[model samples]
Target: MVTPFQVHVHLRRHLMKELPETDDAVAQWCRDQFVVKDGLLDKHALEDTFSDKELQEIRRPVKSLLVVTSWAILVSLGALKFLHWSALLSSWKGIALSAIGLAVVTVLMQILIRFSQSERSTPAKVAPAKPKNGGEPSETRQNKEQ
Candidate 1:
């Protein structure tokens, strides 16, 4: 949901000039340690390396604006399509309500996006094995006993 402007501003503010190569040795180092090395290394063990402060700072307003603007555009256009502009002007309450409805919808969609991504990823595949005790021994164990 990050907009181009927010991304550009963040990079410029942080003085980030270029992206790191995926296979770079430094990338591996950062995986176990902090990529930024802003004295936050080794804080999170194997978990995502994102900082909540940075995340909230960046994500909050960026996400909000994206929602708000998209809402504004979509609602305005949809309203214009569904109802006459003159009619909307006559009923100020209806126009205001539609705007509110669009804002609520935008927020709801953002929440759902966050939750869906946070859901646990599917586990890796594993081969099936014989039951432990179904009145029969595993083939390997039976062979070893013989």
Candidate 2:
């Protein structure tokens, strides 16, 4: 079985020699190189499919979100500095804000991690139909009926 990591390494090595000149060329190259299942390049069909420009565009919004989030956190911290530590901890609103901030940061980190990974290309495997009534499979039964 060819792993997705192996496929990524292969694509990167080949692409380094000759990058596709256009989007259509890139799509053609991908199709010729490996089977694309449901528009995804990997066998597992996770979120590991994106062009270079698409990745750049995704990163742009994520970067802006991170910057804004960071500033908000800094400002929150500055505001909290004026209050006593006990008061800050006892405040439910402050706790909720901190939780929300942590969640947003966690999601952004996951997105960054996912996009930083390489692409994969492999054929998806189709499982055989299970036998019905402890007899022939559905396909065989249908063929017999026909």
Candidate 3:
């Protein structure tokens, strides 16, 4: 999961400007600038600011972390069920283990919730980039010039 701090760092590194001091402000800035539709960053909207390689770099870690965390929770739940079925949960050690598992799941859930909240915020529309010449878009003008 990508924390607001991580998003702030990425924005700072990519945009090279001072950002809002608070995490919520930084997150809001991201929502305003980028197209986040349905809890996902729109890569097409990011094309103007980030290269394909950079987009992939930003996406990979979050995807991998989510997958790993989800699998961990599932495995932990399965283990807890097995322990209970075998009557191991009757012991103090088993109770401790269950508590630890519950705590881990709780933390993971909180992370997921935060991420969802950040991504699911209302996204501002990105206006099309217009050419200063006022004849055509920059891309088309560039193509014609070439």
Clash pairs, candidate 2, are none
Q: Give candidate 1 misplaced runs (Cα > 4 Å).
A: 1-78, 119-146
lDDT of each: 0.63, 0.67, 0.68
What are the models' TM-scores?
0.26, 0.26, 0.27
**What digit string (tens of lDDT, one per residue) describes model 3 on residues 26-117?**
88978865653422334434543433345434346778889999999999899878987977679998788778988999999999988878
Best candidate, lDDT: 3
Q: Candidate 1 vs candidate 2: which has greater lDDT? A: 2
lDDT of 1 by residue, 1-146 (tens): 87665231222133234445544655775574444554444444344443454543434667888899999999889868776745654577977977788799999999999987966779989877546566466786777779
Full candidate order by TM-score, most accurate first: 3, 1, 2
RMSD of each: 13.5, 15.2, 18.3
Q: Once model 3 is optimally superposed onto the true structure by TM-score, how far is the C-alpha of residue 71 displaced, in angstroms?
A: 17
Candidates 2 and 3 compared by lDDT, better number: 3
Task: Assess candidate 3 and give its lDDT.
Answer: 0.68
